[model samples]
Target chain A: MRYWLTSAFIFLLVTAFSQEPPSTGFLRHLMDREYYKEVVYLLEQTDYDDASLARKDSINYIKGWSLYSMKALQRSAGVLKSVSRESPYYLPAHFFAAYNHAHLGQYGTAGQTLDSLRLENSNMASLRAFENAGIALLQRDYKAFEDRFNQADTSYYPIKKASDKMLDFARDLESHRKKSPVVAGAMSAIVPGAGKIYAGQTGEGISAFLTAGGLGFVTWENYHKNGWKDVKTLLFGAVFAAFYGGNIYGTVVSVEITENEFQKAYDNKILFNLHIPLRNVFN
Target chain B: MFLTKVSGQPEALHRADSLFKEGAFFEASIAYERTVYLQPESKVVHRARYKKAVAYRHLHRYEDALRELDRLPLFSIADTLKSRILYETAFNHLLLDKPEEALWNFRRLEKTREEPLHSSMIPLKILILNHNRKWEEAKGTLLSLVDSMPLRPHKKQSWKDSIKSLYDEDSLPKNYSEEKAKNLSRFIPGAGHIYTGYPWEGAASFLLNGAAIGFGIHQLWYKYYFTAYITGFGIFYKSYFGGMKRAAHLAEIARHNEMKKFNDKCSAMMMRILK
Candidate 1:
């Protein structure tokens, strides 16, 4: 038995030494084929048993790229943050980082990242300008939005179309906000709900104007009676004051809500292709 | 069946072991299977079976490997070997997404050990319980385990530091009272933050509301009517209706969670007190 064990050990030792190491090319092949999720998992579980810089860099690059594909912006940012500036994958990492920041609505950070790459990435200038216009619109800086939109290159079909549509929508929203506030206030001053109608909130304007006017007439009539004197008159006065103030406030809120709703609808239509002509995934 | 007759079987088994060590897993499995059948009672045969299971796991044939593990009980295996099998079995279950079964086996393995349990097992137990969604129970277990861990050598400091973190998570205060905050904030701006023990935030909200109202009045006085109106509108809405709405939502969440926690704690306490 002892002699047999010795012979077997010797034979296995020889066989073990002859075995080749596993190939690293398999992961790259999978990635090139766009089996992205598979590559991501394999990269996540890549052996960190050896604490080498080259190994760490490869792992980090794979993670950053995979997360970019998955559209997990914040997590991708966290993984990509570890990559050094001098690495071969550095430029790609910066591009992804900027894209992620934009998706997160961190416009300033996204712009900053883009600015850093301007010397090398002149091709994205039009894209940057287009996105800048979007950020300006969100900030309610109409002047900045106009400036960015005008300067944006018309050669890029997507950005040009987006900017043109946004320019119209922004102007429409500004006009609506400016007009509704004045029109609704004047209508309320005249008949209450009529102001709501003028502001295009016809139902609310009519209700408010009618309620206030009716209440004002009732209180004036009641105060003229001999039985209910100072206290009842004072109570009616307070009610009148509240309705008067509330009518004004109500008109403003309605206009704001309407404008917001319109803008939200327009944005959804543009950003999510809600009203756009496109071949959808489900379709 | 004779002792001398069995000596020839070890040669084949050893050759299989060599093949396995060399990473030729498929060939090794076949050889090990033949050896085990040839000398079913030998310890060497049982060892070969264990190695076969390892080879299967490495090859990612987890289910097939786990089957061989289930067959090991019929053989007379050592306590240490049994522990390893149970551990590996539980790990396989985890890989298969059978966390509950893995937890059961892990617990069984824990119970079999004597004084001074392995530190690695504690964290593994906590993780398994966490996966099972027994968070509070897991927290309690970790706390007790941290307290009992040996504080001896320099190398053990890393373990101790980890245990300290366990204690911190377990002992964290449950102090988010949404109901109280909402109730307080409903009638007055910034009151919710105060009720929730966020005094600085409460103060800031009050100051902000006051400043907004003040700015609106100043704008109206200066004849910037549009600015004044918008600012005034924001102040009134935020202070009264918006504050009330936020408080009510926070209060509802707090009340529901607190009631659940109270009921669960009382039941658990009653069980302990009565027992």
Candidate 2:
């Protein structure tokens, strides 16, 4: 292991193992440099069937973590869960794998992973309860949220702020009102931009009102001056008709889009609350 | 110590070479990267960097290839590799849609006192210039390339004559003026589309504008001033301005496409003569 002879030894080892993949030393170097994508690629090329148990744990942990960084949640969960129980990486891997499943909306699988994890340290039990509570919030099971959250230590540093956000979200969800697209369309039909305002687009609704009402006024002016057969009267009348029809259709669509947007924003917050605690505890 | 360093370095590099020969570019790039990282000051480090770039190119990671090539010690690199490194850099830039950067490196290679280097770069230069709308330069380069061909005088003269004819006034791509096209469409709707080689589109645009204007004038004659102004004139104004913008865009596209087509023909003729 002398400094000068390290290169010679590495040379001999590489020559003797020419058929093998790149060394774990090189892979660890890639990890240190944050070359997660290359690490994933190298791990894929490597065959560790005859390799030591320690090396297997190292390779799987690296691959699992890299895939997690890439947001390949399903594969990350699978890889991380495969980190053997005896390996030091097993506990963090189990927690991340469970979170990945919950993020992917497989709450049953996520709960199962958590259920299977055997906590060695007392702090891990609190972390597990907090994670379960997060999954409950994400799944919109308020009763389960109450039960799981009460068991979790809200004062735990990693879950502290996230715990407060969870309470606010619970209150918001209880008060959340769902808008009806049919009502929005009917409202728009009665008043140019009324439906859009109902759907949460006040500015768009006001713009629609001015544009449609302006066209209506122009059509009336042309009709009053030149009669129905006047080209200007007919053109303005036709344009106004199209605008009125399109406005009603657009209001209904906008209401539906707004509803989806609100739902997505809420879900992202839940996912964030879940993510911050895990990253805090592990990283 | 020297023997140990020599054995260690080439062993890693040889693994990369083996992967490259097997067409396992993804693996080769990793191996070459290992060589570069572990042997940063070695003479063969530049070779490792170059090989890594080549592997990246094979993987269709042109940006990554360019990054690896950029790490080479430009001043101390062998003259032969320096020329090739320039070529590879230009090739990657071209693949990345950076024709200006590609042309800069190709021009540098043109300065090398290497005949084959010029011969290799000339065709690529013409192709790139043609696409970039440097028609005159592409023609001149093609003609120079023809003059340098080792062919019978009669055969070479015939090939050069064909190339010249291809770039002649009537045969050359029409350098459509986008400003002129837009102005034409301003004064006469659809005229720009015709100039840019789409007569049907021009006719449709003209009809739409004509209908809107005719309606406005008819309303005006009937004393419906507000209708004439708000409905008919408003529609006409929007369409007219929109047509002018469209005509300008079409003119630019027509100029690019026609130039590209003409260049391809010139390239084909040069290839035949060179063959």
Clash number for model 1? 9
True contacts kept of 2: 0.28
TM-scores of the first chain across all predictions?
A: 0.56, 0.84
How many angstroms is residue B109 displaced in model 1 relative to the true structure, after the best TM-score fit?
A: 26
What are the lDDT scores of the predictions, listed in order?
0.60, 0.81
Lowest summed lDDT over 10 consecutive residues: which window, candidate 2 chain A?
A: A1-10
DockQ of 1: 0.02
Docking class of 1: incorrect
lDDT of 2 at A4: 15
* The candidate that achieves the highest TM-score relative to the unseen native structure: 2
Instruction: Report the C-alpha lDDT of model 2 over B1-275, residue by residue, as the tens digit.
Output: 00123348788899889989999888788778788767878988899989889889999999989988898877888778888888889889877878888888877866753555457667777766765667688778887887887878898788778877876778878889999999999889999999999999999999999998998899789876766776679889999999999999999999878876886787787678667
Candidate 1 error regions (>4 Å): A1-96, A99-106, A118-126, A136-177, A180-183, A198-200, A224-230, A253-283, B1-275
Task: Spell out the clash pairs found in candidate 1.
Answer: A16-B22, A187-A195, A192-A209, A193-A205, A193-A206, A193-A209, B178-B251, B179-B251, B182-B247
In model 2, the number of clashes is: 0
C-alpha positional error of residue A114 in candidate 2 after TM-score superposition, expressed in Å: 2.7
What is the per-residue lDDT of model 1 for residues B156-231, given as tens digits with 9 covering 90 to 100?
A: 4554454345335443324456666766775567788666555676777767777777876875786545445544
